[model samples]
Target: MINIANTKTSSTEQKNTPMAFLELAFRPFFLCASFFSIISLLLWGAMLNGSFTADVYGGALWWHKHEMLFGFVSAIIVGFLLTAVQNWTGVRSLNGKGLLGLFILWLLGRVLFLMPVNLSPWFIILVDITFLPLAAAALAYPIIQVKLWRNLMFIPILLIMTLINIVMHYSIVSQSPQLMNNASTAMVLLVTLIMTIMGGRVFPMFTANGTQTPRVNAVGWLEKVVIITTLVALIISFNIIDLPTEFKAGIYFIAAVAHAARAFRWKVWVTLKTPLVWSLHFSYWCIAIGLLLFGVAELSATVSQSQAVHLLTVGAMGTMILSMISRVSLGHTGRAIVASKLMTFAFITIILSTIFRVFGSYFLTDYSQVINTAIVFWVIAYGCFVYIYLPILTKAKPGY
Candidate 1:
């Protein structure tokens, strides 16, 4: 029961404010996440073509994976949740110097990952691992004060993500590829679970409001089944439970079906007229499809795990983040919730990027070309976001 209402501010309050950017958590975080994602993708593209080389913490492959999840995606998650929690619990989240400190802590972790000078692994871990727990604490305080027990689920999820991040960094120290791979997969699933929970809460409401349609009621039993199955799939992904391949596949398949059914109740077809709404629906479908493909990969020789993962990462996470930020930034800033024409094009481009990255691998002969093409689209998509939203994020809302 998180409230999604817009916060109102007086024009006099916002006018002539010197440090408006640091006045809220979303401003600095959303801006930084967009820029960081663009740079990271460019570096990844260069590394793929052998034009760039870097000796960073845990090597380039590890850095790319770790940063995209813990670095890029995690920033957006914290920013969104911190902002939303304010609306949820009717208490102010971090702002001003306090918000800046948390943002700097996250930025420092990213800086350490890219520094040419060899840094102590422990130092990097200490900095990188500190952000989430602090964010969790900030999030928990307001909810606890209000006794909003229903909203407290997010605290544990953040803490668990922190634990997984620690394990990921430790994999580098232990030099265990299996551990690294398992931890990475686990993080992906964990984020997907976050998306599942958040999307279920917000998407239907968003779709109904945006489309002027009646709100669809969620089946309580189905909601619980979807979440429980997703948790089981996540546990299986982490290798925490010893399950047969068939059993694992079954759990994933059930989760996928449950997700699809849940989405079907939202009347996704009607959302085609709205880019902001449709993009979310499409992204959620990617999770359903991704889960099915991932389950198939476990039992079939034809399906590759990387393909399934790319579908979830690029299609589900990337598009959903872009769409959510676009809508949230506008709404929070007192602008209309509609997407600009260019922003709509950016949305389409990112979906294309995911298609090329995931399905192109199956059809194309030159794998490098597929990877590079996807990178180009990704850069264009996020580049548009950074360009269009820069002013909107930096300045006070119009009419304040």
Candidate 2:
């Protein structure tokens, strides 16, 4: 297990704050992300049931989607990258006051978006969108110092995501609902692309390590096909280029087959006995299944686009991120990388939640009940995360 304390931190920071949690990137950010997951779901459920609404400038549904994607998920991405970049380059990323400042900026954006205060759309954009580029800047200096050109790919993705967010806000400003929807859809595809890249890097490696098996290898041609086809599908999905649905479906179907082929080569079945390992594999499978459904939905009138998207969002992205944050938190905090019983249960519950959210619409006549059931499962999953890790994240790292 990798320990955060083993990372190169100076003695000045070691003694600067009694709150050792602020001394590293993952501590506060992961804690906040997990907490926000719970709160956001509950509020979204209430919005679905007509109990209450958010105070944001966009409609409640848009606010919910944006916050869940950008507000909550982005925190995990930044936290993981900040922590990982240090290990990659042997240089400090963010620590002490700098991390705290970033966290505060994130909190400010969330508050401005959720509260009833009358903030300008441009103001929200300014506060909310600053976090990603700033995070990229923090990582860039170290990566450049090490002359790691490949690692620089993440910066462009961050900038693109930031651009999408700005475009989303501009859509709100102009009251163009379709534009807002398109921008949000683009953001989702962009995140999925990032997940595809990261999952390709880590899933097979983790499976090899955990299962004591030979490293699962990627097929060179398959990787290239997936990247090219997924980019095409994303462009078509963006709907900004005015592509035909038939063309989008064809590209999406090809992307789906390629992703499934690659994932199958990873031998995920061997990971079943290990919750931590299997969760990663299972979530990857979710992406493959989601993409297949996404393509079919474009071609078939019977399948709902919402279901396919949820399969990716809730089943794949949510489950993968939750498992990762849990695993990484445990490893970095000087604990065993093994998942606890509660954590295992959390993983299972989230997978079940994904099933309900993604497929329940087809099974049941009333969609609201499906949403309610899925929300309950989501709460349980994230609640377990907060229950298990809240104290660990706040306290000093072991031997600090």
Candidate 3:
């Protein structure tokens, strides 16, 4: 029901400054995510062996996941919502030093946390957790001013995610057991919620727009079904570390069915032509399939969590982010919505990456291979964005 086109470009800001940094949303965050991702993964890979040294952080692996989920992905989320919220509410989003300050906080958190806990972890925590709330506040202001109720929901979700990251960081430092479990569960749920919200909003709209056909919502009941099953999957996951095999198996089976049913009604067959569109459709399908495969593992002890999370991470999250970033960049910069040949190549690269990552999980039967291959594809997907869209992200819109 959101009229996306109507809400875009309402309050215009000048883009003629000597600095062209504020031209669009993807500029700072995409740049940051790209550089940080490469460095972060390399750091995590090193830390896995005990070769990595840091002053304050206890577990390197924990720091790795924390950075990936909270640090890296969080940057992308901020860039995205800032732009999207501006579009949805017809308000000018953050720019100038405010935007740069947010990026710097993220950068400093990375640097500070990696070193010894010198003065206090409090300083690092404050910087690490501040970005999301600030982003939420920026987005929420305009939406609330216009009495936009639906978009308002995203603010609290961001807040909760930020809080979860806060708790997770504290738990890592203090060694609180429950905090770790809760944060992991919360991150998975947040990922699922992201899949649903963006999937629902963009999939049908993209399909209809690209195809010049009437729009199609997935299914009336599927929305509720998706949320319930995602939660069910998370709840069952917690029990896996402790509960009996049979108990976990039963719950996972239910979760799998719910996930598959939720995704099936979307009619992915019709979306194949638009790589951007189909990639998302396929990605959501991966979420369902991953859940289903996970259920199979629980019930029959076939595939492992490592395998299933690969499917979700590489298949669902990887492709979705690639598709969204590609589309959002063109649309936001006042460019035509058509993908260039090179951009189209980027799309294919991501799909291949998803396929390789998922297959590495299933076929190679090596956990490291799966992670390695998935990281390759992730780099391919995001690297392609940096390669092709850098100009769009960095330059002012034509009229600006």
Question: Each candidate's lDDT (Cα)?
Answer: 0.89, 0.83, 0.69
* Candidate with the greatest lDDT versus the true structure: 1
Q: Relative to the unseen true structure, what is the C-alpha lDDT of residue 285 in candidate 3, on a scale of 0 to 100? A: 80
Ten-residue region with minimum lDDT total, candidate 2: 1-10
- Candidates ranked by lDDT: 1, 2, 3
For each candidate, how many residue pairs have backbone atoms clashing (under 3 Å)? 0, 0, 4
- Model 2 per-residue lDDT tens digits across residues 1-400: 1222235456676788647788677888888988888888888889889898656557787788888888888888888888888887777678888889999999888888876466666777789989889988987888899897878888888888888888878887788888877887777777788878888888888898889999978888888988888777677766767777787888878888988998899998899888999998888888788888888998997777787788888988889988899988887777878889999999999998998898887787898899989989988999999999999888866776
* Clashing residue pairs in candidate 3 (N, C-alpha, C atoms within 3 angstroms): 55-115, 55-116, 56-116, 56-117
Candidate 2 residue 176 Cα shift, in angstroms, is 1.8
Task: Give the C-alpha lDDT of model 3.
Answer: 0.69
Among all candidates shown, the one with the greatest TM-score: 1
Task: Show where candidate 3 strays beyond 4 Å.
Answer: 1-12, 15-18, 46-58, 117-119, 176-182, 234-252, 355-362, 365-367
The candidate 1 region of ten consecutive residues with least summed lDDT is 9-18
Q: 2 or 3: which has the higher lDDT?
A: 2
Reference-based TM-score of each model: 0.97, 0.95, 0.86
Could you tell me which residue pairs clash in candidate 2? none
Candidate 2 regions with alpha-carbon error over 4 angstroms? 1-13, 16-18
